[model samples]
Target: MKKLYFVHLLNDYSGSPRVLNQTITALRQQGNDCTLFVGSSGHGVLDELDVATHTFTYKRFDNRWLTLLAYVWSQVALFFALVWRVRPEAVVLVNTMLPFGAALAARLRGAKVVYHVHETSIRPAALKSFLRRVIACCASKVIYVSKYLQVQEGIAGVPAVTVYNGLSEAFQRQAMATAYQPVRKGRFNVLMLASLKAYKGVNEFVALAAALAEDPLLKFTLVLNASQREVDEYFASRSVPCNLEIYPASSNVASFYGDASLVLNLSHVDGWIETFGLTILEAMSFGIPTIVPPVGGPIELVCDGVEGYQIDALNHELLVRTVVRLSKDSQLCQALSERARAKASEFSTANFQKKIVMVFDEL
Candidate 1:
């Protein structure tokens, strides 16, 4: 059996790691020998899987300079360790552009390197350029999560393919079982799941909630991918509206989806373009209509006036109007819900598995 090394910088309960976990499961089911090299930062979805694991010290910091220093140090250490660890003819799969050390080591050790590109909005323009240059020089093949990302970041000569992210079978099964029930009556819940960052539109969501606070029945929920302490610190100076509720990071979001009348991804396009909205897809699986950013990967998933509406996160007036319209119009919401579920079926776990395996095999 051929050896495959999967390297990811952080193993948090985030989109990239979750996608990597699903990919590893698929590859292992096909009888491939898979080994994972991840950071010892926090517990993650990858922990559920039983596999051979190697961890390196890495952690996020509150100070920007400290964080940058730690990240560069981790890469330097990872380069030497990966050079010694990876054997000839083995395939190295780097989860994101941040972990360029794996690609360098793979190229130096005479192994093939494949990158699964997930995000395009990395801070510090020079760092982003450096990582792109690494991909150009070292990667043998590239996999982009969305066509929008491929168009935005595709290298001139590097081979690439676009694979839409998929919902895990377990998540699909749960959504299918829960969505068949009657929609909750009385209160209307507008939900947004994202990291606790300004670019992610946490401020916009809070503003929307404040704008619609006059209607007591309309509620807003924000599930952030951060700890409770982090959430508290982020909101220390800001006043939270009564209708809006905030929650820390969680793996189980089925209950939120089940209770939601509408889902929203309010990413600020200028600051951060959402390459693909995983939370929007999860909402679709639950037969809930979504409001996502007008640009980037979300447009491919949702059609305006169909599965959901695509509106700019900065447009507060339009967002308020849309929320009021969806809250009052029950029939329209039901119609969109059915279409949303159907659109979600096109990007299934089975399809993701088949496409990913084909990419690896061809490489």
Candidate 2:
């Protein structure tokens, strides 16, 4: 196995950083020397992970132009100071925009580069296009987390491969441990695990809760990364329903799945194109059927009415009816949950590792 260095964009606990952490662990386990370099840290996703990580001076700024300038300046300074010092055979830039500097650093040192793209920026099309072109020009191989994202980026004439994100071992174990149990004929707890971002449909979730508030048999809980007090204040400011509760995001959400009769990932297309629905996959891994939107990658994960329901963002009636049926019918929920568990086998850590290693080998 060839040794490699990685230039990661951020240190947050999003899907991209989680994938990066796993990639380095897998590479190191396969006897390849690996190192990860990040611009800054915040959410502490990479802090506990066992990997060789180093920091650089590329701090993100509130001003968009200042952010770009700082990124460029840090790239040049680190190109000689850090990347050159490491002198690995390859440099893996963890995301597209950050590749502006990492790619040049790799090119100057004559090191192979793999641009791992996890972004699907619809706004600022010009910026996305320029980054795509530059990444295509510099990268030896481009890895996209989903085919939808690959199509969205439009990085034509570049060597690329699509590797769908897979579940961690602990998540898979959660699925394996899930046993179909009969629900009592009473109120059901439906959960929505997502960030408190507009693109993620938190507002839509609140709206849905309000719409379904008349149906007193269903309770909605939103698991997100915010304090209960802040969430309560936000709810107080809005027309939040009495049937809804918002909780902070947790590493251990298997208990949330345990409490939920149905899970949701209702990202709106106009606001956000979900590259891959990590929450939906995690829900499926727990044998909990997902109620996903028909917009982006989540549609690719579930077979409507088989594994889960895919309702359009505009179809309020359909979404409401699906919710009512799932809440009332335990048999249907159990059937879909079983099918979801079966579908999750397609995205396993072992399989993902094999594909990742194959891509590195080919590169």
Candidate 3:
């Protein structure tokens, strides 16, 4: 087995980190020596992983680009030192420009660089230009989570492969704890599961809630992973209906999915569209029918009128109509819920691990 080093922008438990930890586990099982170098402090979630890790002293993911630029500059020497000492056979860089600094350091040491691309949207033309160079020149190989993301990036003639981000075994166990069953009694639950980002259509969801405020039979819940202050700042001016609730993000989200009748993924096209919406499958595994915008990697995951509904976010009428239909019809809800669980199983961790191992073999 080759000695491998993994680099990620954050140690936090989001899409990139979740996929990174799982990749580490799969690599370890094959008897490969591995190490992880995270760009910033994790939200203590990295402690659960068994891999060896070193994190940089850094700034929060925010508007202040200088905070990130300064942190990257500070870690250049340290990252170079680590690469020289370990001399890994391959260094896998995960997500965005966050790990570009370390990738450079690894390349300097003559190690093969593998970049895993989770983001499809790049801003400020200059950043996109730099990414193009990095993919073609620095990386010996590039990995994409979904073909949709690969196509969205619109970069050609690069050594790249697509592997769907898999759901964790821990999550599979949690999914098992609650059977794939839905009871459509009482207030019909409609959940929007996302962090409070403008591109996530936070404002759109609020408008949806208000438009359907008179529907006493339905309730809307925003399951977000932002600080209360941030959440308040975003929604303070909006009028939340009596049936609407804002639930803080938590580790124990499986229970919330269990209680949910329908889930919504309304990420805007202006920002990063879902490059394999991991949460979409998470909800499906619990037999929760979801509503997603007709864009991005989520289109690959959901088949409209089958497993779940996919509507254009700009068309608010369809969003309201679909939700109303699913809530009133218990049979439709159960049918979709059952089919969703089946669809979710196809993208299981075992399937993802096999694809990832194949990529490593090629590398």
The per-model lDDT (C-alpha) reads 0.90, 0.75, 0.76
Give per-model CA RMSD: 1.2, 2.8, 2.3
- Residue 45 in candidate 2, Cα distance off native in Å: 2.7
In candidate 2, the residue pairs with backbone N, CA or C atoms under 3 Å apart (3 or more residues apart, or in different chains) clash, namely 224-249
lDDT of 3 by residue, 214-333 (tens): 988888888787767777877778688888899765667777887788899888866767888888889998888988878788889899898898887667888889888888888888
Q: Rank the candidates by lDDT, best first.
A: 1, 3, 2
RMSD of 1: 1.2
TM-score of 3: 0.92
Q: TM-scores of all models?
A: 0.98, 0.89, 0.92
**lDDT for each residue of candidate 1 in 1-363, tens digit (9 for 90 to 100):** 569999999887789999999999999998999999887788878888788998876778999989888898888878887899888789999999998888899999999999999996887999999999999999989999999999999998999999999999989988888762223667889999998899899999999999999997798899999999999999999999999989998878888898999999998989989899888999999999999999999999999999999999999999999999988888889899999999998889999999999998897
In each prediction, how many residue pairs overlap at the backbone (N, C-alpha, C within less than 3 A)? 0, 1, 0
Clashing pairs in 1: none
Across 152-171, the per-residue lDDT of candidate 2 in tens digits comes to 77466788889988877876
Q: Sorted by TM-score, highest first, which candidate order results? A: 1, 3, 2
